[model samples]
Target: MDNVNQAEFWQQRYETGSIQWDMGQVSPPLKAYIDQLPASAKDQAILVPGAGNAYEVGYLHEQGFTNVTLVDFAPAPIDAFAERYPDFPAAHLICADFFNLSPEQHQFDWVLEQTFFCAINPSRRDEYVEQMAALLKPQGKLVGLLFNVDFGRDEPPFGGTKDEYQQRFEQCFDIEMMEASYNSHPARQGSELFIKLQAK
Candidate 1:
């Protein structure tokens, strides 16, 4: 398998339709999260990293959020997303390595994590936490779903326990909420955790 850290690996998956993690639409729990965001959040900078097909990014644009950014290492999904939302700011559709995204140039008020965590190699989990903390503004939140079950494989969508996540993220964030998601897509119903952590 190609290294998960490289664009070639993800790009090949997108080109070959190997993205089993994509649910074809916004995850239910995340949709609920987005729907409740106050109108004042409309202009806050939001980042969606590893956004395959970017359905959540599309949803945010549809809801009138003006400063949403979507980053994917693969060009295929980024191009597909651009076609899906032609009017979305071209500057915001960044195709870059998430780890390489410089904190000096890119910082968000909040971040929407979907299946991105489990997609990266597990060895980089701490690096993921560090980069996420660096990417957020002070007290900004990192919110979304995580797989609660271990996939027992060496691949993307690699899974882990809530305890591991809590220990990892707590290094840079204050765990505001981490619990079983009551509204995941039927297929993922009992397997996902909806998390909301504010940068420390």
Candidate 2:
């Protein structure tokens, strides 16, 4: 599919209030990771692509993180986020397709992956990996959770096995950690893998 089509796909979901993957709170594993980071790291450039509602971005802003960018092609969620956090830097709230974003225009110390990977077209998985690598600073990390099971559906939230993810990401990242998440939400328990991969 193309950019306009992908944007409309997500826009319709938000317009209809059908965002089930939205946890309504910062993800537990991600929150724990944020809590452990040093205060000085708050200034690190962080990006959260496909950030619907962006609970993590709000949490980061509340925690004093100075530079957190939220990118999503859909306008509905971005508008909602602006109303919710009026003080969040407008420049950081980007409304653009993740694939179209340029490294020269936007580079980050880290990119927090949540449900973004599974939201994309499966045929574009390799391109996703490449774009992720290009957006990060050298040795930058990509951290978050991934579904470890197949949903067997031809739609968003596409799922995959550990072996598939390992092979796919190894092309651009060194897997620092990708294992069963002990702190996953109840619904995702045992079926989610928390990943911490560094640019290769």
Candidate 3:
């Protein structure tokens, strides 16, 4: 549980089938968001970090978005995703630590978050915010779901409240929206917040 920063932790979890966070399909809230994206945004650079099983990446590809990138340090899920989407462009599948991604080399129009934020060590939350801001183009959006409730656990899927998120992210982003998601998956209904934050 303490090895959240290590790739082996997640890699071993994937090998042992311990990924409770894996939704097994594209998240419904994200699917709805993707569906409403204008066609002009199709080719915009998109990053999906900690993208285990990468259902969102697959969904994006299926929707004709040509420049989507998936980043996950764990190789097991990345390899499995490659097998699941053989026709997906190999170059876009980056198996690297999200924190190590160079801002000079990679900048995104928008980044999609799923469970990635909660999976990291909470102490690294500020680092996550800094790195996310550095990785995005000016005014770039960060859209995804965040747990609006506390799990009170000492493991992955660490949760927080909306106030904590606002205090953490407002330093680098304009809070466009952060409200309870009406379209969350049944199991997560009422517990998650849909956030759309644009980089300042």
| Segments in model 2 whose C-alpha atoms lie over 4 Å from true places | 1-5
lDDT of 3 at 148: 88
Please give the lDDT score at residue 161 for candidate 1.
99
Q: Could you give candidate 1's per-residue lDDT for residues 17-128 as a string of tens digits?
A: 9888788998889999999999999999999999989899999999999999999889999999889888999999999999999999999999999999988989889999
What tens digits encode model 2's per-residue C-alpha lDDT throughout 1-200? 33323788889989999999999999999999999999999999999999999999999999999999999999999999999999999999999999999999888999998999988888999999999999999999999999998999877688999999999999999999999999988878898999999999
Query: Which pairs of residues clash in candidate 2, taking residues 3 or more apart in a chain or in different chains?
Result: none
Question: Pairing residues by index, what is the TM-score of model 3?
Answer: 0.98
lDDT against the true structure, per candidate, is 0.93, 0.93, 0.96
Highest TM-score, which number? Answer: 3
Q: Residue-wise lDDT of candidate 3 within 1-200, one digit each (tens)?
A: 66999999999999999988878889999999999999999999999999999999999999999999999999998999899899999999999999999999999999999999999999999999999999999999999999987899899789999999999999999999999999999889999999999999
Q: Give the C-alpha miss distance for residue 146 in model 1, angstroms.
A: 0.7
